[model samples]
Target: MDEAALREMLDAVRSGAMTSDDAVAVLRRLPFADLGFARVDHHRALRLGMAETVYAPGKTPEQCAAIVAELLAQPGSSPVILSRADDEQAAAALAANPGGARTRATVVWRPAAERAERVVVVTAGTADQPVADECACTLAAHGFRPVRISDVGVAGLHRILDAVEELATADAVVVVAGMEGALASVVGGLTAAPVVAVPTSVGYGASLAGVTALLSMLASCASGITVVGIDNGFGAACAVVRLLPSAVTTRV
Candidate 1:
């Protein structure tokens, strides 16, 4: 449960509108819910100002659906996210939990509140869009407004240069790139905002299937840039969330 629900419960008890025993019954599954296959983290939103997400890679389709259902059962505004689901897994999970807005590699279960903070997600090329889509989904699900600037790779210096206003105005930036991943360095140099870089497995042999890009981003000449694993858009989005101030309310 979120802080609002907890406070409301306590207020009900104080006014004699609800019994202490009934309140205890409602909170019995807090901290986590043991679902045998997985222990759903019901208290994460209360602690982190963000909720837990279900990673759907190794788990069974049924397990993923069940976990999603359990998370949806909580009383909070943060959306329930299921990431990296294949066709079968997405079908199954979306079937059991029918309302998530689906995107490439990710699905979001609730309509997040629109906040004022702006996060710019920039991709090196058209090929990097799938990774950028994943990052956008996570950012929107967590209530951060994601501004997408697409196919602005450094190969055409004029393209990324054209987006200077969009880049410079953001509260945080996520750069998804492949090949030498020079885009991250370019973006890092362009914006004063905190930048998080993602190396995608989108290049040929010499790119080392993203390792070359990963290393290039890690050793970027631009100082204070953060690099995440290859094609890990969800993690990149989470990093952006941590970098920005929390939009979720504390006393509401």
Candidate 2:
């Protein structure tokens, strides 16, 4: 449960609305919920200002669905992120438990309050959208607005320049690129905000399936940018969320 729910439970007990025993039952699940495969960390919301995220890549669809179901059963309304979810797995899980017509495991959550301090997710081209989408999804789940600038690679410098205003105001920038991955360095030159470069496995034989891009990003002359694992959009997003101010309230 989140802080709001915890407060409400205590307030009810203090005002004679809820019995002490009943409150005890409510508080019992604060730390976690024991699923056979995973101990769902429910307390993360209280500690990190964000709910525990589900990583759907290595897990079976049923396992992923079960974890999400447990989280949805919590007392407070908070956003959850499921990273790298398999399309088929997500469909099956959502079909089994449609989230009360309001929520969708696939439908990302966006906060209206953070429209101004939104993160800019710049993609080198269409091939990078999947990794870019992963980054954007994580940011959305964590209550930050993410604006997409597609196909604006170093090859097309003018396209990126057109978005100077949006780039300037962004809290952080996530640059998803493959091939030479030169976009990150160019973006780093332009923006003062921290740039998180993600090298995707979207290159030719000589590119070494992103090894070249990875090395290029690591060796960037840009002094202040950060680099994540190859195609680790979730890590990039988590970094962005840490840079953002603590969220004041849980979003429905």
Q: Which candidate's lDDT is highest? A: 1
Cα RMSD, each candidate: 1.9, 3.6
Please give, for residues 1-252, the per-residue lDDT of candidate 1 as tens digits: 766667788999999999999988878889999998899988887887678899999999999899999988876677899999988888889999988888977889985777788899999999999999999999999888799999988889899999999989999999999999999999999999999999999999999999999999999999999999999999999898777746444434
Q: Candidate 2 regions off by >4 Å?
A: 100-116, 249-252
For candidate 2, lDDT tens digit of each residue in 32-122?
Answer: 9899899999898677766787777788988877887888778875665555666766775567557522222333322223435668999
What range of 10 consecutive residues in model 1 has the weakest lDDT sum? 243-252
- Candidate 1 lDDT for residue 201: 94
Please list the C-alpha lDDT of all candidates, in the order they appear. Answer: 0.89, 0.78
State TM-scores per candidate. Answer: 0.94, 0.86
Best by TM-score: 1
TM-score (C-alpha, index-matched) for candidate 2: 0.86
